[model samples]
Target chain A: MIVEVRGLKKVYGSKTGVTAVDGIDLNVADGAIYGLLGPNGAGKTTTISICTTRVLPTAGQVRIAGVDVVAEAPHARQYIGVVPQYNTLDRACTISENIFFHCLFFGFSRPAAKARTAELLEQFHLTERAEAYPAQLSGGLAQRVQIARAISHRPRVLFLDEPSAGLDPQSRIAMWDAVKGLRHQGITVVMTTHYMEEADELCDRVAIIDHGKILVEDTPAALKQSVGAQKVYELHLRDQPGRPELCARLSRIEGVSKAEQTGDGVRVLAHGADGLLSDVVSAASPFGLKDMTITEASLETVFIQLTGRDLRE
Target chain B: MYARAFAGLFLRDLYVLRRELFPFAIRVCMNPLLFLFVFTYVLPHMSGGAAMNPTAKMAGSGGGFGTVLLPGLMAVAIMFSGIAAVALPLAQEFGITREIDDRVMCPLPVWAVAAEKIVFSAMQSVIAACIVFPLAYYIPSVPVQAHVNSWPFLIVVLLLASLVAGALGLTIGTAVKPQQIGLIFGVVVVPITFLGCVYYPWAALKPIPWLQFGVLVNPIVYMSEGLRAGLTPSAHMPDWLILAMLCFFLVFLGWRGIKGFYRRVLG
Candidate 1:
């Protein structure tokens, strides 16, 4: 593992303080893309902050490439690349200079800094914007510049926090492509985001976090499989009938794995049996079934299954 | 390796300041230039200007008003330059722009990052003092009587004064909020300059009794008085006291500022 987090914890105050991270442990393999999938305020950002040494851990330790981040942050920084939620590109310098100065900060000679900056500009397709100031760039373009600059030193681990937040569809796709390219360069990536599709699409492994605790950690496929269904069918019915007995009946159906009553409906988790939909409709219609919505079992279903709450909510 | 990383930070500051050279020069030169032109040249050259110039009369005999102002104005330049170089940029960095992360994330210890700001600002303070010197020397119609008895004392005072000014800037930058920066000029900067003995000799303020005793708390008073003793040899404070106070202020302010910076950056 390139990144090892052992019993990591952070608290904002003493005793009665808000615990930002609560005894989290993670081991990310070298050259793999990992995701901490959670909603806002799930301690994902706090975990990343401690790993990058921006925030001190109240307990435990994080070691990146064998160097402890808390004990030798400056030494650890050489192997760490971070793209924070906010754009931290130096506004005083042009795009090229931003990368160039970053290289210098890591002790690259002037010639090496310039050459590496030029290479990164071309690699990130930012050559045309080399002379453009950060303020002159659009939000998406500035984000690209920040990512390019963060990797200027070729760090072993790259951390991205909410990489696609506030981006348009096109820019989000572009950002994803750029991140996928980093994997080919042999950099381990650990990203934090609430977007389930992003974790399903990009991460080899995903950890679902809520209220400063890791609810589960596994491959997205395994996590979805662990939910024990291929589809989730939500049936909104009009009458308030014997909800528990009705759910019991639904759960006993051949393809249905679980059934529960939600705020406005009955939720059924079922496999894609040939006649499951009609069977569900027949069972639910007596209560004046008003509407039905079907969604494939996804990382979101995995989250809702574990936490009993929607990721977005 | 630490030295190399430290140099990289210094080079970055140098590069940015070089690009801003024109504005930096204007900020450093304008105050002393205008002050010398009006007080030393324009007013002294005016008919009956001598009668109107109370500071010149106080300098007595052949000593022009420029003699007292020489050290005092240089102190002002050094202080302002320090503030401009560190505090102003810090306010913006800690505020909306928030681009300080990359700088702080450099492969140096956190205190080293804050130390770099002080060192860079101190260099600018020295440059500002140097710029202010010629303006004070050549502006007045009458010859400014600057008699330096000890070059070592003069050099030591200039170096100490520059570091002290930079430390003061760091303290202000870390203490003041970005929104409250404009107000600091009014509440802190201007008031200090006025009471700092910048326009007159400290000894001359002795007649004012309470005001003289009150201004003793101002660090700028020591700066102006130190320069006066070193460069002009007028009625200034003792050298040992000036050195001790400058060191005291430097340590106190640097400690506070670096602590604040760590809190701001490290969370």
Candidate 2:
């Protein structure tokens, strides 16, 4: 395991305190991309902070490459690189200088730092803006520079907190591509994101977290497969809901796997909706169906199934 | 390895300062330049000349006001440089950008990061002292002979006073809010400089007994008086007491500053 977290917990205050992180245990394999998928304020940032040795845990420990983070944080820092949720690039220095100085801080020789900085700038497609100050760059460009600088020292583990948080679609894809390229260098990556697609697209394994605890952990495929459906049809009725017979009648359809009553609706989960949408619509029409929506069973659906709420909430 | 990290941070600071050398020169020289130009040169050259000036009478010598101000202005330079180099920038970093995060990620202990700030600020303080020394010496109308009694003693005071200035800057930088940084000039800088034995010698404060004792707690008192003992023919506090107080302020402020820095950066 490149990153080992054991029974980790962080409580903000005393006995009746708010627990930011509750008993999280994870073992990430070398060279694997691990994602902590959660909503806002779900302890994802605190977990990464603990593993990166920025925050000391109230209980338990994190070991990065066999070194306990708490006992020797300085040593642990040698193996970990971090791109926090916000840009931390030195405002005083240019892009090239930021990366060069970072390498120098990690004991790189001047020439070595120069070479590494140049290589990172080229790798991240930031050579054109090498002399630009952080404030001069757009949000996407600045984020790219931050990523390049974070890994300039060649840390084995990189923690990116919300790497795609304010980026445009194009920049987010570029960021994902840059992260994927790191896997070729045998670097273990641990990232936190609320975007389900980002986690599904980038992670080798994804852990769904809520209210300071991991509710489930699996490959995106397995998680989706566990949902046992490909299409989700939500039927909203103007009339009374919680009608068990409506759900029972809908589940009897050919492609429908299961049906459950919601507040003013009945959700039908189906493996394939082909030739089954008409049957579902007709069955739900008797309850005075006001609206109907369809979506594929994705990580979002998996999260919704586990937590019974929208991830965005 | 720790040395490498420290050197890296130092060289980075040096590089940044190198680019801002002009502004740095202006920042360190402005206060003493105006003070010397107005008080020592303009005021003395006006109507009644030296006779009518109460400050000249207070010093009790015809060409002594400039002589007294030489070391006193140098002390001000050092203190202001410390605040400018360390405190002001630190407030911006801690509050606005959180740029200090990258430096803290270095494979060095957290305290070393704070130490690096003080060390870098101390160098600027030393440079500011050097800059102000020459200006204070030559700006007076009477060409007051700013003689150095002991070069070795002068150098020692310069280094100690610089370190104490940096420590003081660190303490202020970490203790205050970034939005409230302007308050430092009114609350910290003005009060300390006025009560810091800059305009007059500590010996002259003997008539105001309570104030003389009260100003003892201010670190700039020792800085101004120490430079007085080292650089001029003016009366100064004893050598042992000056050295002891400088060291005391350095340790006390350094401790408080480092603790504040640690808390601000870490969880």
Candidate 3:
């Protein structure tokens, strides 16, 4: 494993009594893009903070590249790069200076630091902005510079906390590509994000956490399957008297797992094959259903099923 | 191990400081210029017939008063530089921006990190003193006669004073948060400047017995006292006493400041 966290426990205060992360176990293999998917306040930041040695863990063992973090945190940090959710670069310095400082912190000599900074800036497409201070950069540009700084030293593992949280669609895609490129260099990437699609598209394995506990952990495909084979179908039709009762009755029929009227439409939750399509079509024939569409079991659905709350909330 | 960490921190701070070098120089120049004009020229010319004592008058008369103010002004300059270069920036770095996270992550023990900050800040303090030195030579009645008698003493005193300020800056930097830093200036720094013997000798504050006792706690007073003793032959304080007090304050503040720094950074 490139990273290992076992029985990590962090309790805020005795009287207050909040366990941010309670006995959590994690194992991430090398070169894997592992996502710790969760909503806000799900201990994602705390977990990453502990791994980065930003906050001392109340109790646990964390190892990066087989080196004990607690025993030798500074050396352990050499193998791990952390891209915090917040911008931690010096706002007073230029983009190139920021990268240069980061390299110096890791013991790089001046010329070597300058050379490597140039390479990373070019790679991140931030070479033109080398002389610009962080305050002069756009949100997406600042985040890219942050990534370039984090990776300038070329650590073995990277911890990114909501790396693209507030980014626009195009910037988010660019961030994802940058992350994917890290994997090609055999760098293990661990990230936390609320964007379900981001987790679905990038993560090889995701650990879904809620209320400081891992609700589920598996590949995105396995997680959706574990939730159920049932794909939800929604039928937008004119509301009629006794519509909910009729939908409930239809749900009790063979081939349909559950059905309920939500808003002006009847939503049918079904399993098995598309053969059930005929049964649903016949069942809704009398209701004059229109604009029918099928939706798969999204990570959001699995999260809601497991935790009973929207990821945003 | 410490050497490696020290070099890294020194070089890193130096590199960033170069970008702000112009502003930093301007800031260092501005404060001392204000003090020099107000005290040596404005205050003296405004007040009749030497409310300033003869030692001060003579020191002020032959274009030598500026020399007397030089060391004290340099002390103040060094103090401000320590606070500006290390304490204020460190408060911010540890606070919202939290860029110190990167330094704390360096492959060294936490104490070494804190030491690097003090060492780097001390280096800046020395640079500030050097810049202020030439400006101080222009102030009237600084006892140019004393300069040759005391150049070596002056150099040593300035170095010791800078170290004391650097250590104290570490304490302040770790003790306060970024938002409260302005309050530190209002409450802590203002008193240190006025009572810190920047304008008068420690013995001069003695006649107002209560005031002297009150200002005794200000470490800047000892630094200025040491500088005055070194730069002025007829300075009120004894040379040995000034040296002794400087030694004491350097050790006392250094021990406490370094301890707090380690705990804050390490924890």
Which candidate model has the greater DockQ, 2 or 3?
Answer: 2
Q: Model 1: how far is A60 from its true place, Å? A: 1.2
Interface residue Cα RMSD of candidate 1 after superposition: 0.9
Residue-wise C-alpha lDDT for candidate 2, range A34-66, written one tens digit per residue: 999999999999999999888889998899999
Ordered from best to worst DockQ, the candidate numbers read 2, 1, 3
Q: Of models 1 and 2, which has the larger DockQ?
A: 2
* Local distance difference test, candidate 3: 0.79
What digit string (tens of lDDT, one per residue) describes model 1 on residues A213-301? 89999999999999899999998878867567678879989999999998877999999999999998988878778999999999999
**lDDT per residue (tens digit) for residues B1-267 in model 2:** 899998999999999999999999998889999999998888777855562334444443445588778878999998998899889999999999999999999999999999999889989998998899889888887655456778888888888899889889889999999999999999999999999999888988888899999999999999999998887767779988999999999999999999999888877
Runs in model 1 lying further than 4 Å from the true structure = A240-242, B45-47, B51-61
The lDDT of model 2 is 0.90
Off by over 4 Å in 2: A14-16, A240-245, B51-62
What is residue B188's positional error in candidate 3, in angstroms? 1.3
